[model samples]
Structures are given as structure tokens and as C-alpha cells.
Target: MVEESAPDRTTVATVTRNTASTITAKFQADNSEPVENKNTWGYVNVTEVTDALQDTAAHDVCAPFNAPVPNYRAPHRRTIQVKCYEYIWLIKYREQTILKNEACKRHRLNLPKDVNPPSGERYTYQGEFPHMGIIGWKDKEGDYIFMCAGSLISAKFVITAAHCTNLRDPSVEKPTPDIVRFGDRSIVPEAADAEFTVESKIHRIIIHPVPNYRELYRFRLTE
Candidate 1:
């Protein structure tokens, strides 16, 4: 096999400083500067200029701040680009601290659990499923229909799907049926053995701004 020769290096014009004035100056004017300074600045060697050029070229080709000590290779090179608008919100809200230490201390001290006993009944279960219970309802024809599924998130608020009680269409005559079921494995009304009257005073309905309508119906009917 023939021996391969190393790639020939090409000499590229390199600049030690990149000031706009130096870049825009004519080549003749730039070369004349050192010559004019020779008498005033003492004996000027052309080799010194060549050495400076080589030094600048070497610096440009070498890795910055010295190579890694362990000789590991980087998977990729990092490029940094910044946008002013991206940090505008963060800068504007920098001083706003909603959860101050004093407020946090007060909130921890006055936590709801320590204030009162859970208003609704509680149950324990064995298995991987959630321990919370839900209430179911029946239709006029006595067919089992799921009204809502609520968890005792707090003493006053029962967390359930908002679609259960809301109107699908305002023009429709009837709103979605309201039935609450507790301790039931399936949507069958007969399956529910215990029941509780919804305290209208404490009962509330809240619709999420981005509610998944398709999943909402399924959650209300099931868990």
C-alpha cells in the first residue's frame, strides 16, 4: 500500500485584535505603521511580527482554557444564545414572594387537619386502589346512572367532576341528574349499601378552565 501524506496546512490571515478601525484600515497604511515606528521604537525585527502572527494562529486553533485533564471527549459542543423577552417575566416578578417565611409558618400552624375533624365518614381498604369513596344515583326508569364521584378533600368541599352537575347545553330542559353514591364497586345503584344527603349549604361545583370533556363523563360515571 502507498503511504498517505499528512494534509498540507494553509496559512490564513489572522488578527491579534479585532477592532473596527484596524479591520477597516487600508493594508498599505497598516504595514506602514510599524515601519514609521522603527526609528522611535528602536530596532524592529520582522521575525517578531511573524512570531506574533504564529502565536495568534496557534491560540485560535487550540482548545480554550487548556484541554480537559482526564482526556475525555465531549459528546457535543455547547452554543449559547440569549433572548431578552424570555427573562422579562422572571425579572418583573423577582420581588414578588407570595410564600414568605412568616406566612408559611402561619399556614403550617393553622393547617385544616389540626383545626377540625373530617366532616364526612372515612373508610379503610385493602389493595392498590384509592381509599376514597363516591356516591351514585338512579334514573327515573330505575336504571343506575352515575351522578358524581367525590373525595373528602376537606371538611366543607367534596372534590368531584364539575361536568356531573353542569349543563351540557343551556337550551336543554333538564340539567344533568344529581345523584351521590357512596361505597359502591360499580355504577349499579343497588350495589351502593350506604348513602348520605348532600349538604346543599356545603355543596359546591367548580369547572376547570381546561376540563377534558370526554374524560370528565367517564370519571363522573366511574371513579
Candidate 2:
């Protein structure tokens, strides 16, 4: 009890320096009394503590696992091609200036300059021509009068008016005309080509059910 153990010589300088500074030594008291200056017992680096606290705050703020990442391509726009034939037709029709002027004036359509109108002169018939013929019955004087217009329907069968056959009384005993003209513009009865002569008698007649008499008259009048 009289002699105290020697203090660590190595820690003596450190203890002396700590005592000389504002820092103090601390030790636990007997009988569990409160220790004096217990907070200063161990060496603490303030810089290291501050650095660890800053790193923990940065990791909490970033929150790396909480949110999903965005797709770079999701917001992009696209274009599509389309074909438009009816729109092209409308554009072409709208651009004709002459047609536009006519519409504005409320006038009937003016024919284009290149088309030639039919001449007023009647086509007189001469004897014995080809392809051209008058479509009518023969009079008592053996002359063909005009009935309705006709074109050659076939070689053997001359297509003419149903009225042409029906107009005359059935009591008249004469056969229908066997002659057909070829290549002649005048309305004349003449011998046809060999094929026409061979096939001429087998004619088929077709009449429209609703004969538009006004249109037929207009066509004949114009001709």
C-alpha cells in the first residue's frame, strides 16, 4: 500500500501534453461515482468523424434503388405515307381556266377548238355504191325513201327499222331488199362484197323496249 506501480513511460509524454492543453484526463471513480471529464477519455479525430457523417448523408439522399429508369425511345414521333387518287383528280379538274370561265358565266359548254362540226349539206345518193344505203321501203317507182337511219349489222342481214318492216301492209307480196352497198356514203342500194352477199339474208332485228322517241327524233334531226 505504500509503494505505487510505475506509470507507462511511453504514455507519459502524451498524458503530459494532454494535461497542459485544454484537454483533460478522465478515470472511473470508486464506488461508481461519476467520472470527471469522462467525455475526454479517448482520442477523437474531428475530421474523420465529419467525413463519415457526410458520406452517410450523401448515400441516403441519392436513393439509388427506389425509382425506375426511363426509356429513351418512348416519346419519339413517326410519319406514314398515303396514296390519294381522288384528290389528284379534283386538283386536275379545278385547274382548267376555260371551263372555270364557262361555269362562272352560266353558259353551256363550249366545244374545244379541234373538233369539227358536221356540215349542213345532205348526202345525195348515186347508183351502185358500196357499204352505204338508205334504210327504207321501195316506192311504186322503185326508189328508196328515207325511213330511219341504219348501219350494216351483218353481211347477210341489213339492220333496219322494225317500223320499216311493219309500216307496209302485210298483203304486199314483195320480198325484202337483198342489195347492200359497201364503201359508199350516199344512200343507194347496191351489191355488197362477197361476204356480205353470202351472209346478208340472215338478219337479226333488235328494238329497244322503251324507245326514247324524242332522243331518236333529235338524233335524226341532227343527222
Candidate 3:
């Protein structure tokens, strides 16, 4: 049987700080600062990257599959390829995971189980919980509605129930909240209100894996 060659593909690697300026200059001249184009997928020459890193410790870490370690593989001989967006996604995932873990460790709150006793209801909360907030949205008729509550988990992220997000009902459909109001108690603001409310536009919404809410609703209604 005759020996066959591997399929040729270009795999991109992270740009080094030394050549970043040069690359940026080139892109600036071309008038394209890494703009995503659905028509054409971008690629990088992995062989060039491997050859450059051959003498460095990085070559051993990211060497392509079926390639020998501590050696430079010629550009024509390497055939591994990866999409540019996929590589970006992996980097973002790693960075976000790190941030999430750090946030978890910093805000691991532990309180007594009997924090709230069976006392009579109280009307006022004197800024006891600064992180608590009210999530609000505007309906199609330009009406402000307070649907659910959320907690400020981080400076950029708000932890809230999944039901607060986009929802659909047999009779009515509702979009996700457009803004989050913090430190606001009254859903309807009054002229006599003294509390300060901070409103911020939501960038993203992450829903947690939960049991079927419909089943729970049915069970509750029957009970």
C-alpha cells in the first residue's frame, strides 16, 4: 500500500507580545481590526508558530499531535487546523471560569439557619442587606413591572432565579428584564421615597439546571 499524507490545515496560536504591535500595524493598514466576517473563516499558520517556539519551553506544551517533542515541524509537514472563534471561545471560557471560582471563594456566605424567626412581619428594612435588589422590566405597553428579586453576586453579575428570565405562557409571552434596579424597595417609586436606587443594563442571563417547573407548579396547585 502507498503511504498517504495528512490533510493540510492551518491552526492559529496566540500572538506574542513582541510581534503584537507589528500585527496591529498591519491590520490597521488593511483597515480591518480582526472583524468577524461570516463569509470567510480566519486561520493561523501553526507550523510557523511551532517552528518559532521550537527552541522555547512553549513548544513542548502545545506541540501538535503525532509530532515529536523539542523539535520544529516544518510548515508544509504540519496538518492540524483549528477555527479562530473556537480558540477565542476556549480562552474566554478559561478566564471566566477563573473569575467565577474566585468570586465563589470571596462570597461564600454562611449564616445561621434560624436567622429569620417566626416573629410578626416587619414593614421596613433599614439597609440590612445592601446587596439585595429588585429586578424590573417594561412590558410591550411601556409599563414597568417588578417580576422577581435578585442578589448582586459580583460587580458585573447578578444572581437571580431562572423564572425571572424570558418566559412563555399559554396565554401570554414575556421577554427578559431589560434592567436591574438595586436598593429599591417599592416597585412603584414614590415622591416620599428616601432609598436610592441604582439601575444597570443586564449584559447576560445564565439559567441554572433546575427541575421541571411545570411539574412543581402542578403539584403546588393540587396541594
Candidate 4:
């Protein structure tokens, strides 16, 4: 009798621990076999599976289903270093040709051939200015409202007018922005052109402490 090659021990252990219930369920469902232990969790529990999947996903930075690079991962601390890391990572992974070029193009990393963009709304499309973003707040009626326009110069920071963060009328307090949407062009929610818009919540707001025109004028004259 010919003997079959034994499978790797680690692979076997991983498969047994990970997919035993899944395989058992499918097999039992098809073959009409009763679970040996009914009350001992025959099926995979949702929470257990979710937690396990999350743990595994956290380790794989390049996994397709994992969340995109967070704003905190902005390579601004050392621009040259980040650029080099990105370049090496792409080349080592054999993604240097198309994927590398696409990324560089999107971030305006490399020198681009001068092509005059058409003036106005006629020439623009969704995701053209990925840096451009919007700040949104929720009204008392539970409606998500657009508060102001901003630009995403880095991963974590958005640059917007100071007036948007402050109000002169004591009755009008600036509500914390509940939502921040990136790569969206249209003001109307229904008219959003971006299919994969990046979104985040405003955790903190930093406004400059510049004085009003009257105060500035007086201070300038006095100084």
C-alpha cells in the first residue's frame, strides 16, 4: 500500500484550531449528522470568532480587509525616511511597477508632466483633491450637518478657517464636529461622488488665538 505524505504539524494544528467548527458544520449539515455535544458550543460563536479575526488582522499590515493606514501613521516626522520605507516596501513586495506609480501619483510624490487642468467644475472628478475634506456636525434634530470646508495636508490634521471653529454671537456656540469626510466634492449628501470616502470623527479641535480686527487694530497702534 502506498503511504500519503504527512501534512505539516503547524498547518494541521492551525487548521484544526481555526476551521474545525466551520468544516464540521458544513459536513454535518450535508450528511445529516447530529452534533456529538449539543450544549458545548457546536457552532462558532460570533464574539469569539470576531475577536480572533481582529487579533489576526492586527498583525497583518498589508492585509486586504484590514483598515487603511491611519492618520497617525503619517510619515511627516521624517519625510525622507517615510519615502524610503515606502519605496523599499513596494519594491520588495514586487509592487514597484503599477501600484508604486499609482500611489506616487495620488500623493503627488513624483514630478508630474505638466498637464493644465481644465478650469472649473467641468474638468474635475471625484477623488481629484483627496486633500480636500469637509467637517460635519450633528444638529439637535439628529441630522448630520456640514459645518465647513477643510484641507487634509497630512494624515491626522485638517486645515480650516478659524472662523469655522468660533462664533461671535454668545448664543451661537460651535458644536463639536461629529464627522469628517475626505475626498468628497459635492456639498449635498446624496450627490457624493466618491465611492470609498475616508471618514473619521473629530476627537479634538485646535483653534488659533488671534484677536478680532478691532482688538488687533488697537494693539497694533499701541505697540
Q: Write the per-residue lDDT of candidate 3 for residues 195-221, one digit (tens) a residue.
A: 356777766665545644432110000
Off by over 4 Å in 3: 1-120, 169-173, 191-195, 209-223
Writing each residue's lDDT as its tens digit, candidate 2 over 166-213 gives: 445443334343233344332323322223321122233334566642
Ranking by lDDT: 4, 3, 1, 2
For candidate 4, write residues 1-223 as lDDT tens digits.
9999999999899988679789767767876545443344323233432333444344423223322222212322245434544444434333322333333233342335554334662323344677777777666567666767777656667766655554343332244555578766555665454465777776666644765422211000000
Candidate 4 has its poorest 10 consecutive residues by lDDT at 214-223
- Scored by lDDT, model 4 comes in at 0.50
* Candidate 1 Cα deviation (angstroms), residue 23: 99
**C-alpha lDDT of all candidate models, in order:** 0.36, 0.35, 0.48, 0.50
Best by lDDT: 4
